[model samples]
Target: MTHVMACIDNSQSSLAVCDYAAWASQRLNAPLTLLHVLDEEKYPAAADLSGNIGLGSREHLLEELATLDAQRARLALEQGQHMLEKARERTVISGAAFPELKQRHGHLVESLSDLQEDIRLLVIGRVGEDNSRNAHSLGSQIEAVVRTIHRPILITATSYKKPEKVMLAFDGSSTAYKTIQMFAASSLCKDLPIHLVTVGADSVSNHEALGKAQSMLLSAGFLVQAEIRQGEVESALHDYQTEHGIDLLVMGAYGHSRIRQFLVGSTTTTMLRTATMPVLLLR
Candidate 1:
């Protein structure tokens, strides 16, 4: 069965990820899976110290190094299992049904890719343990996952807040329309008031596109307030979110517009890196 999958680690955002995942699972009435990936690169089972080992004690040193590597790998695996169990307990406390636990040894994106077929929604932190120290930097895995995973992804902030209002950053692109269609079809966030906002010129075409999207949501029984803001896409959206007190931001993951550029581009914007609310990126 399809499920809401949350990627978690020993970061400040992991707890938030679990909370959001439970919320999504309840909203979508889907199973929840807590996934903890022990990156092989970070916790390798064997390290080649042959080059550095002196010739006299090479064999003994290699044996000791292998033993140490094994111990490290074991410790990592145990830690991941403990994290998964704790996350499951937290999810249950958050009012979600029992969630399945999964621990894998590999890259996060690769694990998500392999499990994408059964994922209804993916909830992850904006930054992982590796990047948690740098508050201003987006997790390196985020861009790769966004570019690779076709499923709807909820990139969460450092903390979890039960969302009351949602904003859709529409751009009138095909991907934006797809985002609208998906939002209208899904039960997730259907009970909340939605702000359908577009940051660009207030032209006839833009309004028409906005109207079309609004109509789609309205037909789906969504309370949508469509508006067009004038300024830079990122800044305008950020200001609108602040002014309106939006709790969650929704947008297409990829398109021809600046939104797509900032998301999967060479450089990620501060908006995503410093967003105070969760971002739901639809493919």
Candidate 2:
């Protein structure tokens, strides 16, 4: 069975992510696993340790600091567990039978790496405390997973709405093709309309790529519409989604290194930061 994993932190955005994952689970006839990683390190208690003055003795201060850190870690774990339970219940209601709920007690990124082989797709909220708040950027944990894991990721934003229209960014790249396969095989595309889009500087390749993708999606039984647009990739996508009322944007993540993407301002980076809709990024 296909495995769809959702990273739940019990945040407002994470509830929407649960909804998306539940939809994917029912569509794929896949088992759902709601995962919560306690990023104990990110929740340092030093910020909350502002009460009485510390004793002059070194051992006393060290013990007090250790206790405070342990308390913070416990709180994070409890919250993470609560989020996982809620997410599991949501998926179960979506006809996902006996969904799995996992709570990891370590680094978020590392836990994801440990489960890479079993995970076909990782679902997450777009903006979290773990990620930077830059309008057009991915958070640190999501960025790390995209860079290291050779799997697909569905990144959702604050708003929660069932997908009505899906936009596919095709460049004829192998990774982009994999993204197309994900949508075609997903429940979101069963009898649903898909906009197969190709952005380029030259009209020839743009038209050819769009045609090829549209044909492929049609063969896979999707209602496909092809388009060739001219502009910077991110802006074109952002603009088209706004104009066409796209519900979900599906595309490939960058194959290049972090430094390389920053140097070139890759489309994945821009879309992650700027796109108004949810994005399903394939690696």
Candidate 3:
């Protein structure tokens, strides 16, 4: 069965990721899996000791290094197991049913991609272990996973709160419409109030687009408050979220040409960095 998978690490956001995953699992009535990956790039099994060793002692030093690397790999495996167990316990306490624990040795994106077929939704921390100290820095793996995985991803904050209100950042693009359709079809946030916001000029076409999107949600039995805000996209959405106390933000990820997104960056990335609440990103 497809499960809600959460990437767990020893970062500050790990707990929040678990909590949010539990919440999503319950809402969708899906199984949960806590995945801990020992990234080869971060935890390699071999190290270069050639520079430090002299000609005569090179073989001995290499043997010692091999032993040390094996020991380090074992330690990393043990730590990952412990983290998965802890995350599973926390999810159970948060009211989710028994969750599965998985540990893999590889790059995070590769591991996730390999298991993408079985993933209904993916939840991960906004910042990873390396970037957890800096609030403004985005996790290194976030964009790579976003670009590679076609599944929906929930990038969580450093903390989790039961979501009270949901805001959909709509831009009248095809991606935005698809986001609305996907959200309406799922049970993830069905009963919460929806704020359908468009950050652009209040032209007739924009109003029509907003109205159309709002109608789609209303037809799906959602309580939607549609509005068109003026100003930059990120700033306008942030202001509305703050004003309305939105607990979760939903939007399409990378809704521009590949070159354009690369050249100018993506609003999705900006929102992930700046938003205090959890963000559900749809491709």
Candidate 4:
């Protein structure tokens, strides 16, 4: 079975993401592993600093430091447990099995890498409360994990409610086919109607690709429809989703090159900016 790892914090965005993860978990019949990492390196105990301590007070200061570290660790664990419990309650209500909560006292990047052995999908909130609004395209931790891991990542924003009307942006790429196969096999799309849109290099090419994708999805038991549009990928996709009231937008990330993603930018960047719904980005 596929295992989806949900990295959650106590932020408002995380709560909605947890609900969304639960929704996905039930549909995929996948095991949900709820993870929370305690970033003690960033938020260390203030009392542990020993710059002004004299020789006589060294022992007392060291003892106090130990006590403070213990307290901080305890509080972090307690907070993590509470958040996981709340997430579990939402998962049960969403008709999904409760996830196994995991709390690790370390950095998020390290924690995620350590548990990447059996994880199929990594789910995380778009941004946390501590994150700066100026930051673009996910937080530091999210970016680090995505860049490091090869697994598919579903980054959900706070505004995500539920994915009812879904849109698939197909480009006749291998990644696109992998994404489609995943959606077709998952329980998430069983009841969800999909709009298969293929952006055309030319009118004829676009029509052919869109028709092919529609036939494939129809054969897979999806209530699929096709739309062929001529324009820039980001603009065409954004406009189509907006007009159709799409709730979820699924597409392959970084089709051409990693260098292009950074230097020339990509359609994924443009779509992320213009999309009004949650994006399921496949590698």
Q: Evaluated with lDDT, which candidate comes out highest?
A: 1
Candidate 4 lDDT, 166-229, residue by residue in tens: 8887876666667677667666668789999877665775576667778778888999988777
Local accuracy of candidate 2 as per-residue lDDT tens digits, 1-283: 2688888875556777888888777766678888887765666534444544566646667668768787887788787787777777877775666778898877778898899888877888876654434535556566667777777788887667888888887777665666677666666558768887777766776577667778778988888888877766667777888888999987767533221342124234555766678888765
Q: What lDDT score is found at residue 129 in candidate 4?
A: 51
lDDT per residue (tens digit) for residues 73-155 in model 3: 88998999999999999999999999999999989999999999999999999999888798677898788888888899999
Clashing pairs in 4: none
Clashes of each: 0, 3, 0, 0
Winner by TM-score between candidate 4 and candidate 1? 1
After best superposition, candidate 3 residue 227: deviation in angstroms? 0.4
Which pairs clash in the backbone of model 3?
A: none
Model 3: residues >4 Å from true position, as ranges? 46-57, 256-268
TM match of model 4 to true structure = 0.81
Give the lDDT of residue 223 in candidate 1. Answer: 97
Instruction: Give the local distance difference test score of model 1.
Output: 0.89
Estimated TM-score for each candidate: 0.96, 0.83, 0.93, 0.81
Residue 147, model 2, lDDT: 72
- Minimal lDDT window, size 10, model 3: 257-266
